[model samples]
Target: MSDDLLNAQNDLARALVEARLLLPSGVPGLFGRGTVLEDVIERIDALVVRTAEGDGARAERWRFPPILPRALLEKSEYLSAMPQLAGSVHAFDGTVQDHQKLLARVHGGEDYGDLQKQTDVALVPAACYPVYPIVASDGPLREGGRLVDVFSYCFRHEPSPDPARLQSFRMHEYVRIAPDADDARAFRDGWIDRGLLLLRGLGLAAERAPANDPFFGRAGKLLAVNQRDQELKFELVCPITSAEKPTALASANYHQDHFGSLFGIKNADGTTAHTACVGFGVERVAIALFKTHGIDVAAWPVDVRARLWAP
Candidate 1:
């Protein structure tokens, strides 16, 4: 990471802001999308839906809200590993005097943001977290498996200047649950191939590589090493802001029986269900497309346009 390379990345970030492709909201890692970027994101999502349909997987589709029950997240114990990135919703529940003081602080240009109290819900950390509990509550699977497609706006507190790393973003996920471990593993492997091909169709040269979550703190380094050693996470990365270091626009993860054991999801024969998921960072892929093919949508390659906007 040379200083010159860092400067170049910052220049691109400024260019995007000037071009109205990105609108900074005075908050780092959070930006308002202009029409052009929003259109690109929508088209990318449509392409994902089309590709998922063509994969011949009969998956139940679901759309989840940006926030989920805090208790549900607590049960998953995600905070134990990644509390640094979690976003909890807060609100002002106060009397008139309290409101007056808060209003005065804001009018006087003070740091009044902390006046809000924590709510019962937390912004969802990942699109797939809300799905496991839903599936588990249904008891054992009669057919030995289940396939589902879920999409949601995920929130993390990470603040960075990189355009691809937003505090709030949408994730499109396809998840599989099965009694046999091999069934889930094979499903994940198949999606890795399909996801790479989908990126190629968009004129993005992506490669599948081993990856790990940004686990928090000292104990997390060991967790990350173990995860990579187990080969549990794979990412489809293409260079967006940097040529040498590519960005991960999508990932395929094998959860094994981790969620199943916690949720009590089981097979009819009484075996814990194995789980796997493939997730696409919708905005990140759109950013890569703009970086690779230029920001002008109409001038993009005809094949790329066709694949994204095809009927």
Candidate 2:
């Protein structure tokens, strides 16, 4: 990392600490958010709700747990794409003797975590992931297709000092299961515009840019490139901490029947449903708001406050 980049990280850390928006928990990439920060996040969440519920579109609201079935995750091919980021749940399943040995190892400051065994559950990486299988299992979709609003606490095992890049966070997604690729693409495009408008309404200047997922391995590089080249992923970004490299507060993605094929989701015509989703990183948006408009919520501009709080 460049010296300037390091200094920027340090500066942001100091700002977060001084404002008491976050408390360091002796762990990198994991911090306890203060009430003020929570309030900001709640405001952002209200914005998400407005977007999801607006336009007279009926949406099925869903809230998923943090952990999902490991088998489902594997079927989704998430492990192959970004194994480094995935977090698997592990638990102790040994006898009492094993527990005694584990305690002794802990007391001696040895490697005691090996006593745990991998469980069937893995931490959910995205809010929309768990919804695919459930929707698929219900048989073919109705003639016009389905729209879902899903939210979940997601986890990734990436450890970093930057508060914006968290290991555990919440994601709110508006997903569309369409009849064909054209419908999916149209839904994604519409949301990209609306997402930008949503941010602009909050007084955040955001721009749309083609983006790619952080795929793993050599083969995964090709996949990432193809995804970007095909314009499957786009992000609404603004300068939160770094002016040169903006942070993505929202993302719009068209999966092109990938999830539908894997989970056997079919359309009314017996064809695979095309999938698309618009995701908002709730905490990340709050960080952007704090950085752009300052941490004092009461001092924020009247328009932004009214847009978030007013009925």
Clashing pairs in 1: none
* Root-mean-square deviation (CA) per prediction: 1.9, 1.3
What are the clash counts of all predictions, listed in order? Answer: 0, 0
Q: Provide the lDDT at 22 for model 1.
A: 88
Candidate 1 wrong stretches, greater than 4 Å: 108-115
- Tens-place lDDT per residue, model 2, 89-119, is 9998999999999899989999976899999
**lDDT for every model?**
0.87, 0.88
lDDT (10s digit) by residue, model 1, range 1-311: 67866776677678778879889898877888889988888888887887788655588998889999998888887887788999888889888988998999989999876778888999999899988999988888758488889999999898877888899989999998877789888888988999999999899989998985789998888878987988888999998877777889999999888889988898888889999999999989988888888878899999999888787
Q: After superposition, how far is residue 125 of candidate 2 from its true place, in Å?
A: 0.4
TM-score of each: 0.93, 0.96
Which candidate number would show the highest lDDT if scored against the true structure? 2
